[model samples]
Every structure is written in C-alpha cells, then in structure tokens.
Target chain A: MTRTTYARAIGTALATAMRDDERVFVLGEDVSAGGPFTITRGLVDEFGKDRVRDTPISEAAICGIAIGAAQSGLRPVLEIMYIDFLTLALDQLANMAAKAHFMSGGQLSVPLVLRTQGGAGQRAGAQHSQSLESWLCHVPGLKVVMPSRAVDAAGLLASAIADPNPVVMVENKTLYFRSEEVPDTVEPVPLGQAAVLRTGRDVTVVALSGLVPEALHAADALAADGIEVTVIDPRTLVPLDLDTIVASVRRTGRLVIAHEAVRDGGIGAEIAAATGRAAFDHLDAPIERVAAPFEPIAVSPVAEDAYLPRAPQIRDAVLRTLGRELNREGCRLPRPTA
Target chain B: MTLDTGHQITMYRQMVRIREFEERVKRTFTDHPGVIRGHTHLADGAEASIVGSIAAMRPGDQAIATYRCHGYPIALGSDTSALMAEIYGRVGGICGGYGGSMHLADIARGFLGTSAIVAQNIPQGAGAAYAAQLRGRGDVVLTFFGDGATKQGAFHESLNVAALWRLPVVFIMENNSFSVTVRTEEEDANAAAGEPLATKAKAYSMPGTTIDGGDPLVVQQTVADAVARARAGDGPTLIESLVYRLSAHGNSIAPPGVPLHYPEHEAVAIYGAVEEYEAAKRGDPVPRFRARLIESGVLTGDQAGAIVDEAQAEMQAAVDFALNSPLPEPAAALNHVYA
Candidate 1:
C-alpha cells in the first residue's frame, strides 16, 4: 500500500475513473497543467487533452457544459478551482443539475461530479475560504461529500464518479498537502455513512471533513485525563448518517457537533437537529456545537486561526458534555456528595 | 395529403397541431378550476418559428428553447396528448407536473428541455452542439430564445464560444416585440422593424438572417439555409423571426382597459384571417393540401376529420390517464435527492 497525501488520492481517483470509462473527463481552469494547486499533475500526460481538458476562466460555463455533457451520455467531472467560486455557478448547480431529474420526470440524470476546495488556515482570505457544504445540502438533488482523510478522499471520489446524480465533493485547501497511508485499492465508501474515530461513553463529538482530525486529537487528550470521548465523522452531509449519530448520542447521552463553517446555517446545525430529533429522550444535556464565528474569514493567518474552531474549543465542549462546568482555565465539575 | 408526401405535408400538419393544441390549452386555462395559477406563454403567433425550424432537422437532431417552448417539443415528435397533460399539470405530464408552464422537457423526442431563467438555454444548447460536432455526425442543434433573452450575458458568451469553435448550432430568436409588457421601443431603441438582429453575431464573425415568422414557408426556407450552412461546418447562424405576440405575455396580464390585455380585441380576427387566406392559397399548405388528399381520392374529408377527432380524443384520454395516475410516493422524493 502506497502512502499518499489527500491531494494525491484525489488525483489517483481522477486518473482511475478516466481510465475505466471513456465518457469520464475533467474540465477546469489550469487543470491540465498541474491544476491551481498541483492536484492534477501528470493526468494530462496520461489522458491526453481530449479527456483531461483545460477550460476558460468561466465557472458558470464550466458547470453548464458539464450538465449538458452529462445529459448527453457523458460523465463530466468539473473542477471549480475553489469552493468559493461555486457562487458563480449556483444557477447551474441549483436550478439545472439539481432539478433535471425531478423536473424531467426522471427522464434526465446529471451524472457529474464537482471537485472544489474550501476551509481556512493558509491565509487564502475571505473570498476563497468559505465552507459551503451547508449551502449545497440545502438543494434536493445535489449529493454533498467532504472527506477528512486520504482513504476517504479516494473512496468518496470513486463513489461520486459512479453516482447517477450530481455530487459536490469538497476538499480542504489546508489538508491538500497533508499526508496519510492510502491503500492501493479504490473502494468507494457508501455515502451517508459516518465513521466512529474513537469510542467512549462520556460524550459524543461529531465533526466533519478537516475538523475530524482535530476532534480525534481532542478526544485522545481528554481520554488521558479519564474523560473518555467518542468522536464521529459524518462523511456525507446531504444524506447525513443520522442513524449512527443518534446511536452514538444515545450511548453517550451528550452531543457536540463541530465544523469549520460559520455557526449559523452550518452542517453542525443540521447534525444537531437530526441528533435532537432522533435521540431526544437519550439526551442528558443540551446539544452543543463548536464552529467558526459568523464573520468573513480574515486574510491574516493569526486572525484566520481565531476565526475557525480549534482543539481547545472541542476540549471545552467535551468537558461541558460530561457535566463539568468550564471557565477560561478548564474543567470544574464537582463530584456528587452522596 | 398523400401518405408518401414530403416535408410539405408534415410541416403543415405539425403547425396545425401546435396552433390547435395551444388554442385548446388556452380554453382549458379559462375553464379548469383548482388548476395551477401561472402565466402560460403560448406560442400562438410564432408557430412558424418552431414548426419550420423543427421541420428542417433529422430524427437524431436536437432542440432546446426558453419558456415559450411548447411548440418546439410538440413539433419535435412529443405526443400531443402528453404535452396537453403537461400544461394541465397532470401526473403524466412530461415533467410529472413539477414544471408547470416555464419548464417542459421530453428527452425521447430530442427536445432537451426549457428553463424559466432567461438565456439559460444558450450555453446548454451550445454544449449539446459541441457534443454533436465531436461525434463527427452531421446532427444539428436548434436553440430558440426570445428577443429579451438576447441581452443576457450567457447569450454573448455562448455566441462567442459557438462562433470560435464553429459548432453545429442554429440560434433562432422569436422577436415578439415585448419582453413582458415592456415594448421593444422602450428596450431596443435602435433595432429597426423587419431588420435582422445580427449585430452581435457580426462581432463574432458569424452570419445571420431575418425572416417573416408569420409565414411558415418562409421560415422553413431560412432555417433550411442556415441548417445547411451549419452542417457544412460554416459555424452557427443567428436567425431572427419577426412576429407579433398574439396574446399578453402571460395569462395573468389582462386587457389594457377592460382588466384583461388579451392581445388587441381584434388580434384573433386578424390571425384568423391570415390562417384562412393561407389555407385558401393554392400553393399554401394545410387545407389546400387536405383538399388535395380528398381530390386525389386517397382519403375523404370524413377520414381526415376522423384523424383530427382521434387526436382530440387521445388528448382527452391523456387527462384521464394523468388523473388516474398516483401522486409520486413521498419517499421517492428523498430517494433521488442524492444519487
């Protein structure tokens, strides 16, 4: 098994999908010449210009062409270069691809995948750092996937390629160079499936995409202090794995949902709602969430860190879930005087 | 008239089908209660634009259009029954009643679809044309939008790309004088009446033409010329069909003074005269051709009337077919939400 970065895993999946199906092609600005971030290096060499195509700097046209190609018996994998630019193609994604099947009485299917990157930490600034998984999940026909690790990246990409509908596969810009061991085989992980990173009975910590690793680290630290924490990663937001989240919350009796997006209208709210509805009776405390503050991400690195959720916030949320009162210093739950 | 007749008979039948079907749909809107309340942008005056353009295409050729798309789908081989059911928002409608008036799609008929958003069809149609070009087949694409849509950014962008790539697409603009109550004078102060709106295509180094949309034969000749030009790899052509809107922009817009602006009071009388005169012309299609059918002893008026009657009956039966069909299962909505 070759160890690879999450970025490499994505490239490998693209190459594999292109090799497997002649209809599958990639289109984006600078995608042929190493892409905007070098994720697609060496693909053009193998697939040629016809399959690995470069497009003009038009996001709307890119998405529109992908929809047309998909409708006419082609699987077009479009890259928006950045998730923030998805705003430009919202009409194609929202009105065209999402409603094609339903509005056409199931006669049309948009077998397309959009790979784009989001999240903060590299000082990419307000324009490029928006986490829009929540915005995409709002649309009915769009499938949303955000993978945290190398294996999940490759697995989810293959699944999205095979999907009969449009899928928005978001990768974290900060995690592109982040490395992990990716098995040689490409096994598509089923969408709406959540992975339990750690098992504990004290509290449940649900995180998404890039935030999952921070959540696991926080859980490990808390476990050393005798506070066992269960960490969960909801891989796909649209078909949210509510069953697993509810089961974990039912066992732990506490929930803390975290994501990199701003607190309001974030994936955390959807997960929090699902957890509440499914495991309302099992709750020992109110469900809590840790997310970025509702403000434009700053261009400065120091401010960017402050804008996103961090390890300490996860630790504090976990501590609060265990019935421990938290001050600036940390945990302060007094033992019961039975 | 004759079963072995060429496009002449076929185009006439298709145009009559469209004109009659639209008229019947208008009657239903005024009569049906509890039906959807929205504007049905009927293609009454512009029937030739769709019929003539579609007549020039082959079986595998493609079509796409904007909101005023009922004619294109009907002309492109969609069953008249299904189309009527769609406008009525029945379960058996082309889009399962989800797309009321603004959206109509029938993939089986090669009428890709229509969208409510102005100019959205431009880029999508160009893409399909690109696919046809890539396949090395002589398949052509016919994309229709109104004069109002010509002002959109996608229109300019799509034209640029289409001209640059020399894709096999024919752009037909039904310039119907008004973009929803706003007269063309208020919007396009420079465009002369009866002149081709090809200024944009000029910038792209492409050719364009203007034709009388009220005359299907003229419209047919112009489109055939453009399709031929396109098939020969001459790139896209911008064909403007100058016609008047036979009715208000939508059903909601009532007469100017009498609370309902249903075209001018004499609009129907005028179009009716035109239809009659054209029917009377010896060379004109429709009734004259129907007469030839009877004169040649192939079929009697009663037989032709029976076919029209059967079409009407099938349309009525489709309503029942739609009404009896079950509503989509609630779970099915969630099933397609994701792949």
Candidate 2:
C-alpha cells in the first residue's frame, strides 16, 4: 500500500478522472493556483489551461456555468472556494443542476461535482467552518458524499465524477493533512455504501466525516473496558445504505450517530429517525447522537475545542447508551492518583 | 431585408402559429370554465422577438429560455403535443409531466431547458457555450430572459465570461416594457429595447444592440448576423429585443369554473395606468405584421387566415392529446433521483 495524505488523495482522484475521460474539466476561482486548500495544485500543468479554467470570482458563473457545461456534454468539477459561498451559488446548484434531470423528466443529466471543504477545527471562524451537508442532502436530486479517510476520499470522489447526477463532496477541513495507507490501484467506493470499521454486539456507533476517527478511537478505548462498540461510516448520505445501518442497529439494539454539523437538523438526526423507524422493535435503548451544539463554530481556539466532539464524548455517549451511570461523586472513574 | 420570400413566409407562418396557439390556450379552458386548466405565460406580443431571432439559428444549436418560454421551443420546432402535454402535466409531456408550464424542456431538439428563476438561464447558457468551445465545436447558444432578469448578477457575469473566453453564445434580452408591474421606460425606441443593458455589454468587450422587437424580420436578420459571428469564433453578442407583454404576465391558475380574473383585454391598476395598456395595445405585432404582409403583396389576407386556421386545428389536436395522456406512475418518482 502506498502512503498518501488526504489532500494528495483528492488530487489523485481528479487527475485520474481527467486522464480517464476527456470530458472532465475543473473550474473555480484560483483553482489553477490549486485553490486555498492546495488540493488542485499542479493539475493545471498536466491538463493544460483549456481543461483547468481559472474562473472569475463569480460563484454564480462557477456553479451555473458548470451545470450548463454538464448538460452540454461535459463533466465539470466545480469548486466553491468555501462552503459559506455556497449560498451565492445555491440557485445554480440547487435549482438548476440538482433539479435538471428529474425536472426534465430524464431528458438531461447534470454530471457535475461541486466540491468544498467544511468543518471547524482550524479556527477559520463561522463562515468557512460550517458543515452544510444537511443543506445539500435536503435537495432531493443531489447526492451528498463525505469521506473520512484518505483512501475513501479518492474512491468516493472518483465514483461521484463518474455518476450521471450532481454530487456534493463536502470534505472536512481538518482531514487535509492527515496521512493514511492508500492502494496503488484504487477502486471506487460506490455511493450509498456504509463501511463497518469495527465489530461489536453491544452497541452501534454511526460516525461521519471528521468524527469517524474519533469514534474509532473511542471504540478502542471502550474495548479496554470490555464494552465493545460497533462503528459504521455512512460514506454517502443521499442514497444512504440504511440496510447496513438498520441491520447493525438491530444486532446492537442501541445506536449513537455523530457528526461535526450542528446537533439539530444535522445528518445524524436523519439517521436517527431512519433507524428509529426501521429498528424500533429491535432497539433496547434510546438512540444517542454526539455532535456539535446548535451554535456556529467559533474562531477562538478554546471555544472551538469545546464545540467539537472528542473521543471521550463519543465514548461517554456510547457508555451511556450501554446503560452505564455515573458514580455517587458524579465522575465516571475514581479520582486520579497524584 | 435580405431574407428570401420563402424565408419570410416561413417566419410569418411561425409568428401566426405561435400567436394563434397562445390565443387558443389563453381563451379556451375545458372540463369546467376559464381558459386553460393551468396558468401559462403566453407569447402573444413577443412572437416577433422569439421567432425573428430564432429563425437565424441552425437546428440542434443549444438554447435556453425563461418562464415565458412556449415561444422558444415552438420556434425550435419541438413537438406541439409534447409541449402541451408537459404544460398539462401528463405523462406524455416533454418532461414526462413533472415540469409544468414554467419548466418545459426538450433537450433532444437542442432547446436545453427553461427555468422560473429570473436571469437564471443566462449563466447556464454560457456554460453550454463553454462546453462547445472546450470540445472545439463551434456551436452557438441562444438564451432568452425578460428585462427584470437584467438586474440579476448572473446576466453580467455570464456576458463577462462568454466574452472573456470568446465562447460562442447569443444573450437575447426580451425587454418587454414592464417588470411585471413596474414600468421601465426608455426615451428612444431603440434605447428602450436594451440601450442601458445592451450598452453595458461594451464593458465586457462584446458588441451589443437594441433592435426593433416589434418587427420580426428585423430581429431575425439581426440575430442571424450575431449567430454568424458566434459560429465564426468572434465570441458572444447581446441583442435586446424590445417588445411589450401584450398579455398578462401569465394567466392566473384559477380552478376550473371560477371566473378568470386576468383576461385578454381587461386593463387594470395592477398592470399600470390604462394609458400604457392602450398604447401597448396599438403596438401589437400580430395585426400590424399581418397588415404589412398583406401590403407587401408577398401574401394575401386569405393566406394569413389559412395559417391561423391551420394553427388552431393543430393546437386543438395538442389539447386533445394532453387531455388524453396518462399520469406518470407513482413509483417513477423514486427512480431517477440518482443517476
């Protein structure tokens, strides 16, 4: 296995898609300069200027034009420099690209990929730090994809590009530099397929994006105490693999869904509702969702730290789902030795 | 002026057909009462603007239109039964009945689609042209939106990029004298067409024109010139076809059997002063163009009457087709959401 950073994997996915298909092109403000995240760096040198268009700072054109290009026999991978700017391009992405195929009665397909990085660990402040996957998920014609690991990022993005519909790939900002083992030849991770990272019969923990690793770490920590936890990563949100999730929940009979988006109206809430309906008879305990509170992510490091979910928070939620109560002193463990 | 007699007759027939079709759709509701069972925007006054310009385009060239769009696909020669079925929300509609009057599309005929959002079709048209340029295909794209859409940022950005990349596209602004109810008056006839909006195209380094939308042949000749320029790789052009919304912004979606509020000849406060309506009525292209055709002796009144008769029969057939079409199965919705 070749070791690659999450950002590198994204670049490789783009290069592969471009090499595989001549119809694929990349456009956005400063994309030729590799964008603010540097994921698209050096792709221009290989594909040439025509395919890697450096658009004006007009998000409307960046998105709307991409949709137009898609329908007119091109697959455009458009980058919205920041998820905050998605508001500006929502008309084209939500109303135009997402609705074209269905609204057109299958006459046109918008094979477009709108890529943006979101989440708040780097203190980029409120605007740049929102996990707006829920907004895209709300739009019926769109496919929402978030990959937690470097390997999955490359695979999922490849599949998203090959699909005939519009896909929103919201990457986690904090995962850019994270390195992991990647295969020499990558296989596309199909949309709506969940990956079971750990096997445990006691409880099921569904994690998304940046929180997947935290959930894994928390599960390992819980394993030390003989309370095993099942961790599932729902790679894609729209064509969600509910069968895998509900089946897991039915076995565990308890669930804890997690994400970096706000606690209310986040994707986790939808997952909770779905599992609640499908696995209602099988559930032994009430479902728990570990996520950021309903406040906007703060710029201050201290406040941001408190806002994001930690391994212990996920572990504690899992522990609670397992019906573990606090000691008389209200602490989970005895006082630490000096 | 250089148009052949055959082309002029074709243009006249197209104009009369669209006018007759919209008139029939406007005044004839079945099953209960009112004109149409659903609300639809008519192309009564803007037939010249739509037909004149589109006549210059070759078949299969990419095109887009705003909400008042029946004229666009009709001018492009899309199947009448399909367009009417779509507006009727039947399974046989162009969009399989999913898209109503405001969202008709026939991508196979190269009329890419239509949208309800003001000025939204501009950038999308530009993108199609961008694709053409990338593939080295010198196909020109024509996009139509109302004057109210000029205020949208997409209009400016689309023109800017189309000009910057030398993308083959024609940005047609149908300046129909009103922003729904707000009067956007310009002094000179030409100026009123698109003076402010067309002249602003200079900022993007593209040629812009404010032409006589009242004359279909003029619009056709002018747009044909721009289409040539685009195909020759001269980049995009902005042509503002000044016309009037001779009808209501759109017929109200009144339920069958209720007295329809927005009629063809009723002038009310919602449409501005009666004087404006009266003035616009005098400029209606349908009767004026028919008179001109008769005066030129290129055609007789008998010929114009026959064209209307044929258009009426065809429209009646389309209405029958829509009424008889089936509904989309309920399970069809769950499919095509992906892929």
Candidate 3:
C-alpha cells in the first residue's frame, strides 16, 4: 500500500483505464491541462491529445458527443468542470444519455462516465459549490456513485468505466487534497455496495460522499461517552445497498442520515423514507437527518462553515436519536454504557 | 457527378416511396382514428431533399436526424412495415414500441437514432463522426435538422468542434420554411436579412452551400461534393436545402379522450396565406421530379405511373400490418431500463 491524495488516485484510475482499453478516452474543457482541480493532471502527456482531448466550453455538446461516441463503440469519459455547470447539460444527460438504451429498446448503450465534483467549503460561491447528486439519482437509466476517500476514488471510477451503462461519478472537492493510504494496485469497488466503517450497536449513521469522514469522527466522539455507533458509506446511490443499510438499522434500532446537500428532497429523505418502511418496528426512536439548510451555498467562509453539516451536527443528531442532547457549550455528559 | 438513368430512376422510386409512406401516415388520422398516438410529423414536401442526401451516402456511412426521421431510414432500406408499427406503438415495431414516431433508429443500416429536441442530434452526429475518424475508415456521418435548429447553441458548438477536429460529417439543414406554427423569417436573423441560412457555416470556416431542395438531382450533386470532402479529411460542410413543408408541423396535440387529427398547413392556419400554401402545392417536389424525369425522356409516363402504383400498394400493406400488430405487454415497460 502507498499513501496518496484523493486527486492522484483519480488520475491514476484514468490512466489505468486508458491503458487497459483502447476505446476509453477523456474529453472536456481544459481536461488536457488537468482542469481546475488538477485531478486530470498529466493525462494528456501519456494518452496523447486525441485520447485526452480538450473541448470548448460547451457542456451540452460535450455530453451529447460522449453519448454519440459511446453509441458508436467508443468509451468516453467526460468531465463537467463543476457540478453546478451540470445544469447546462441536463437536457443531454437527462434526456439523451439516460434514455438512449430504453428508447432504442436495448439496441444502444452509452458506456459513458461523467466525472464531476461538488462541495461548499472553498468559498467558490453558490454557482460553483452546490451538491446536486439528488437530481442525477432521480433519473431511471443513470447510475450515480460518489467516492469519499482516495481508495474509493480510484476503485469506484474503475468500476464506472467498466460499467455497461451510463454512470455519473460525483466526487467531493473538500476531500481532494486529503492524504490516505490506498492499495498499491487498486481493485475495482463494485457499485451499489456500502462499506461498514465502524461496528457498534447503539445507533446507525448512514453517511454519503463528503459526510463519511464526518460521521466517522462523530462516531469516535460518541464512543468516548460509552455510546457505540455504526457508520456506513453508501458508495453508489441509484442502485443503493439498501439491504445492508436496512440490516444495520435493524440491529442498531436507531438511524441518522447525513449529507452535504440541503435537507429538503435530498437523498437523506429518500433513505429515511425507505428505512422507515423496511424497519419500522425495529426503531427505538424517530430517525434524524443531518444536512445543509435549504438555501444557496454562501460565499463567506464563516456563513458557509455554519451552513455546512459537520461532525458536531452528526453527533448532535445521534444524541437526539438516543433521547439525549449536547449542551450549548459543545459538551456531552457521560452516560451509562449501552 | 452525373447519375446513370437507372440510378436516377431508383432515386425517383425512393422519393415516391417516402411520399407514399407519409401520405399513408397522414391518411391514418382519418381512415383509422386513435391508431397513432401522441405527435406525428410528416416529410411530405422534403422527399426530394431526403432522398438526394441519403443517396449520397455509401454503405457503412451513418445518419442521424431530428424527429422528422421516417424518410432517412426508408431511403436507407429499413422495413417500412416495422417503421409503421413503431409509429403505431405495436410489439412488432422496430424499437419494440419503446420509441414511438419521434425516435426511430435502425442501427444495422447505420441509421443512428434521432433526438426529438431541436438541434440536439447535431452534436451526436459529430460524435459519431469522431468515432468514425478513430476507426480509420472512410465512413462519414450525415446530420439532418430543420432551419429552426440553426438558432440553437448545439448547432454552433457542434459545427465549431467538427470543423476544428476535421471530423467526417455533413450537416444537412432542410429549410422547411417554418418552426412549428411560426414562419422561419420571423425567427431567424439570416432569413430576415435576406441571406441563405447556410451562411452561418462560414463562422466555423467550413464550406456552405444552398440548393433547391425541390430538385433531387441538384441535392444529390451538392451533398455528394460535401460527403466527398468530409471523407477526404478536409473538414465538415453545411448544406441548406430549401423546401416548403406540405403539412402542419404535426398532428393536433390534445389530452386523452380528445380525438387527434392533422390541422391545416401553418401557412393557412396561422398566417392566413392561402396563396402561399397553394403555390407550394403547385410546386410539390414529388410530382415535379416525375414531370422532369418524363420530359427528359428518362422515364415514360407509364413507368412513373407503375412506380407510384407500387409504392401505394407497398404502403397499403405496411398500414395493414401495423393495424394487425399486437400491443406490447404493459409489464415490458420495466425492461431495457438498463443494458
């Protein structure tokens, strides 16, 4: 195993996929120059300009071209600079790429991977920092996956490129520079599988994308007071590993979902509703959701920090589910071991 | 560039076949109400342009178009019976009735499917061209859309990239004089300024030409030159084929339980221009091509009559087959959601 940043892992995955398959190529605005976050750095030097292409600021056309190329027997991986810009290409993504296979009655399949990042910690303003994975997960023919660590960043992307259907890989901008030790030869993490980071019995915390680390921190903090928590990271959202989540909830009897997106209509609501139906009788208390407020991500660092959901918020939600609360001084009173 | 007498007759036959197929689709609204659901667009007046452009394509060449899609696949030799059944939403349809009138695709014939949205298919065609370039084959792709699509950003973006990359693609713009109910001149700056829509191609540094879409031979020659240039890896070309649509934009759209039928041509219904519509009818390309062929001694009147009779009979059989095809199982909707 070797230590690497989340950004390098993604770049390694791209180079690996391109080397393994001649049909796999990359295209987007400034992708040849490594793009804004530098996740695609050095791809052009290795793959050449034809395979690692730079395109104009045409999101819709870029997406449509990827779809067409995929249909014509080429595997194209396109990058939309930021998740906020995905709105400009929604028509092609939601209409053409997602529906091509179903509309053509299985005659066509778009093996295209659109890699983009979304998070609100960089003070990049509302236009650049919105998390919009919910919009993509709602589509029928689309497979949405989000990776929270360097290891998953490499593994999930490899699986996405090998996938036969169109997959959207939503990465986290906040986690890009974080260092983590990953396997020397990263293995493809199958989509729609949740990883159980920590095992406990008191509460089940379902975290997504950027919130996985925060949930782990909260679990550690709560563990100090004799409260045990289980953390699960659902790597893929569309074909969700609901069976694992339901099983976890059934054991813990308490669930708290967390994400960086707004609470209303977010993926948390869907998971909450689904879990409520599946394990209604197993719950010891009502479910709690820790998410951002229903407003645009602010430009100021202070307001953005307060607006984002973090470990403290997750910890508080876990406390609430346990019929307890954290004081205003950010102190948790020790309780009897559960 | 001259086509042989036999090839010319074959082009004439394909044009008649498209006209007959569109005429039958139009007649179904009255002859058998409720058979075709949702929206259905006809390619009555653009038959010459469709046939001529498709004639320029060789085997292994691909074509993508907008919702006015029936003509290209027919000219490319897809089964009319399955095409009609797809429009009828039957189980035996080309797409298993998953795609209706607006989304017809015949991959085996190199007819990549269509996008119903205006200008959406342009970029897709460029992408297919990109793939063809990588395959190291001389195959080219033809992208078909209407004059209205030129105003969309997809058109400008695709043209710019296709030109910059020197992809093997031909952009065929059939200027059918209207975008739904509005006249083209009212919505297009080039048309308002008395310029052919093809002039927009110059911005991308590509060859652009305007031709009389009512003449198949002229369309055949113009598209052939563009296709050859694309195959030679020079760049892309944009051809504006001006033809007047002979029907309304589509069948009248209404909610369920309200009968649907074809409304009058927008020229008469919206613009109150009966004389304009009548003039277009007098110059309809189907009969106009027939007269030119006969006068030039390329085909006798008896031979043209036999061709039309054969197309009419063929389309009649297609209609009967569609009417008899079974409806798809409702549970089948769950299939094909993934590969």
TM-score of each: 0.88, 0.95, 0.98
After superposing candidate 1 on the true structure, give the runs of residues whose Cα lies further than 4 Å from its correct spot: A325-338, B1-5, B188-196, B232-234, B253-339
Worst 10 residues of 2 chain B by lDDT: B27-36
Candidate 3 lDDT over residue span B50-145, tens digit each: 999999999999999999988999999999999999999998899999998999999999999998999999999999999999897899999999
Candidate 1 — what's its lDDT?
Answer: 0.78
TM-scores, chain B, all models: 0.81, 0.90, 0.99
**What tens digits encode model 3's per-residue C-alpha lDDT throughout A1-338?**
99999999999999999999999999999998899889888999998999999999999888889989999999999999999999988888889999989888788899999999999899999999999999998999999999898898899999999998999999999999998999889999999998899999999999998999989988887888778999999989988999999999999999999999999999999999999999999999999999999999989988888888988888888988998856434445333211
Query: What DockQ does model 3 achieve?
Result: 0.81
Which candidate's lDDT is highest? 3
- For candidate 1, lDDT tens digit of each residue in A1-338? 88789998899989988899888888888989978788888999998876777777777766777887788778888999889999988888898989888777778888989999998887889998889888999988999999898888889889898999999999998788876887779698888798888899899999888789888878777776778888888888878888998998999999999899999988788888877988999999999998888899999877887788877788888777777765334333322111
RMSD to truth, every model: 5.5, 3.0, 2.4
Q: Which candidate is the best by DockQ?
A: 3
Give the Cα-based TM-score of candidate 1 against the true structure: 0.88
The residue ranges of model 2 lying beyond 4 angstroms of the native Cα positions read A326-338, B30-38, B185-195, B253-267
In order, the candidates keep a fraction of the true contacts of: 0.39, 0.78, 0.74
- What is the C-alpha local distance difference test score of candidate 3? 0.93
Residue B132's C-alpha lDDT in candidate 3?
Answer: 93
Give the winner by TM-score: 1 or 2.
2
lDDT of 1 at B216: 66
lDDT of 1 by residue, B91-115 (tens): 6677776666678899888888888
